[model samples]
Target: MLAALILLSVGIIEIQAGGTPICPTITTPDWGEVSCSNENNVGSRCNLSCQAYFDLVGTTGDAIETSCGFDGMWSTATEFECVPIKCFPEQVSPENGEVICSANNFAQSVCVFFCKEHFDMVGLSAANNAHAICKDDGDGDEIGQWVSSDGSTDFQHPFPPQCQPIRCPTTMEAPLNGQVICSNRDYSGSYCVLFCRDGFKFANRKEKIVFSSCSKEDGHDSVGEWSMPDAPSCRQCTRAEEVQLVALIHESEGDRGQYQVATSMIAKVLTILRRRHGINPTLRVNRYSSSVDASNEVFTTAFTLKSSKREIDAIPYPGKGANTTTALRYMDQRLTGDRSAKIAFIFTNELRDFDAEMEMKARNLVEREVSLFVFTLPQKNRARTWIREQLVKITRDDTRVYALPRMRFTNKYKDEVAAKINDITMTKGCDFLI
Candidate 1:
């Protein structure tokens, strides 16, 4: 939109940037047209006006003044050229978006930016719905730059913004005794659904399923995240049934002081369950260790709930490492079908040989309809932390992991533990009965 002027010489010789006066040839700046008025003589004037979209090379004002004198030479002279106005020409539009610009990219043009669906414009450039005005970077070269302008954008093509996938909070975790599935391809309009396993239900009015979707937050133009506050949880089916308790009590030289409590808890769990499962001669108890150095490694004979106390009492101390993979594999061979409600309890200080293989076996045990509970003696270390992580993978349900407040159990806790196990085998709790 801007225009400029240049003063030419009126004389026998045509005016040019560097050429000296010649008899017949004329030279003029390529930036614009030069006017020669009818005669070539002293005092006549030659005029120059820059081409469209080009500004005068140097000096301001409507015109720069100079004249042709009787000496037949240029009176005043300087070197310069006309340049096209623009912001950065190499600019790329935001990904997954398009833009419209005004003025054919010449001076004073503005540009507007728009992103495709499932994407949100990000960065400060999105402040005004993303508009940019053609301008210079504030240096004299005027190579061109787009600057954020008076208000929100729609004005195109300079200082373009970026389009990014929208998002919801990634903080939501799978609930206890249940699983969560989410489809968050671009987070825009994405959703998450929760599923409770068989024999388990949500405590919130006994809901079987729960879910929520992600949406753009009001007043926000970019990626955002939302989370379920105090997230819902899954509780076990409260029903009374026969419980077959299969426990693996780990024994090691340094027991973390769990040898006594682990054994006592098992004996109590069996007693609490004696009324329903003690009579089943097919169900038995045993002590197993993957380490050859461990005592009583083999599980054998008819040891019912009544007779298993002696077996429980004899649990070896300073025995050795507990390889749970072997224990789960051992149980997998014996339990099947719907004859009774089966429960597997594993007691340990910290895990040993508990790897992906062990987790897979534990999951297989759970899928076969067996309730698996892991009792770990509370302590600290990288091993303990690792055990905590692996336990979630094995159980899928963190509720199944029980961390003791102390190395030893009190009579009150022992009874409470027994009662918790007993309660799991009953069917009346979902009805809200005590």
Candidate 2:
């Protein structure tokens, strides 16, 4: 009887458990159906009994539930999405500043409000998502500036205007022969004149008065005319009365003395006589060299005159000391008798006792009527004053004694000496005999 009662009670308890609610169930269309009996539950199941036993004994509520799809899955209908951040360009610090972004960067569509030329960016480029900013240093014309994209700076002023130098025009007119020159900076017009040779007059004198102003009619572009008649023909003296010139050159070995001056004087005298009367006088240039021996080279060198019609000769006298004395004696004899033969003596260095010999000769042969001119060259180490005194004593009170300083013998002083000779000859006339 006890076994029968135990089995029956067990059977009754099992049948009641099948029909009783052990836990709440969840159902879904995709997951089919699920029971929370603890036999096939996905996770901790929700049931009224479990809830009441934990702490909700008096709570009149449905079973507590837990999710069962996936470990981190949530309903897509209830999920909210996160939005992406965006960046934009800000205003440029300097509005006048220009900007030059990279071509690729620009095409990517980034705002460039703060971008500028020769400036640095303060914000993001197209490659980044940050607000962009730009700062312009300034253009080249500014006090402190930078270069542009082309590596050039703004000019403070336009490039200075280029200018060309002025050039004077070249002339081709004859006589003027392009010798015309501009006088000043006023070269815009014709400003040149023509000149003619001395003694020859210009046909265009009125028009060519100054080189600074020339006209086309004045032969500035063509050969001009001569104002004066053809140059006077150089004539030769045929009569003795026209004029007369005689040169006595005394040369010695190792002593050039004033031979050049004597020759020059003779030339001047002849030129003057010719110009005055349009008559070239008969010239007699005689050279007397002391070293006139068979072996002396100077004996063969004859004195020459520029004129082909004039007579020029060199008389060589032998014996150094005696030749000079003999030449002077011959000159005195010739001049004393022949009134036509004008004479002048150029003495070289005074040899031993030569001065005494000359003084004696002067006293004996030289008369007051004979015009004799003497030029004495001072000897080195010899006083010029003493020589001048000696010359005065020999020539007496005559103006024939001319003592020229040695410095006058140089080539540089040749012109001055020639001028002096001309003055002397012009005033005295060729009739003075010297």
Candidate 3:
């Protein structure tokens, strides 16, 4: 009775027990790791993470984690797992080539590479023994890489094979009065384009009207062989009528060498025009100067078509000038009248003004159907920018203008300059002069 009275005074009776807490033992997910806060006990939390190249799914919160609630259960339960990352199939191949993957980019997949028609593979893979492998190497990394067939590693990044264009051998030679340029030295599908020098045309009438390309035949093996039968040739082209040419040479302060070169090249052009094309070409030498009395005079009058070298040598050189404005104005005046299809070649160093007046002169020259080819010689004055911008605006055709670097008086360079001049003239011919 006394014990009962004590229990009643205490309000209730109690019993003690001992064991582990009733917490769920969460299993680790595939390709993922799991860790728990306090062994997943009540009020404890659990966190998950995926291995390399794998991503966690299901939970959208800041972390892949959940807490054990008071109900003795996990607060979050879903199909949370890790997924492997797959690369795009097209990424396996470089441009102009194709790739064949083994299993659509799944783990342990392989890929074989090949080039299209008229192309050949480069590097070790070209020997038909190498391929790309999709392997994890058991290092917890799931990225695959390219490997050689002899168990040798190729590109560190497992890249695709290189496929280069195949072209036939170079059999086309430069025509006598023309030039031939090929896109490739030796392979298939390469092209060779032909171009005739000035006052010249393709020897064949059919070829003169239509330009042809030298190309390799399809399926032709790259054994260093020529597929085209014969190369193109060029001959002296007869003008529809006589064409006249007037040269306005520049004789600046330090351009004595260039002045000499101009005289020599001009003589060559005149001789070629008269002898080859049977045209009576006229030449007028002039200079630029800043002197108050500097006149844009025609130092040599309209000479005979086949002007002698001595005749060209006798022409006096004009003194230096501040700019070529005066000479340009002079050229504009002389380009007038029944000189149909007449071409004017102006050699100058600088442009003093690109004003409205200059534009009108350029327009006048163009109206007379005159082809104005302006040649700018090199100058040491680096601070002064050339008037190329102004010339483009004036002529409205920038292609008709040309610029030359500092004079290199080698025969080769001189010939090249002459060839360029002729090329431009033949391609952009003037009309029949009355």
Once model 2 is optimally superposed onto the true structure by TM-score, how far is the C-alpha of residue 321 displaced, in angstroms? 2.9
RMSD of 3: 15.8
Task: List model 2 lDDT by residue over 111-211, tens digit each.
Answer: 23332222222222211222222222222111122222222344232111111222234432335322333443222234444444322233423222334
State the C-alpha lDDT per candidate. 0.59, 0.35, 0.56
Q: Say which prediction, candidate 1 or candidate 2, comes out ahead on TM-score.
A: 1
Name the regions of candidate 2 deviating beyond 4 angstroms: 1-246, 255-258, 276-283, 287-319, 322-325, 336-341, 351-357, 363-368, 378-386, 405-434
Candidates' TM-scores?
0.39, 0.30, 0.37
Full ranking by lDDT: 1, 3, 2
Prediction-by-prediction clash tally: 19, 5, 11
Give the range where candidate 1 is weakest over 10 consecutive residues by summed lDDT: 17-26
* Candidate 1 lDDT: 0.59
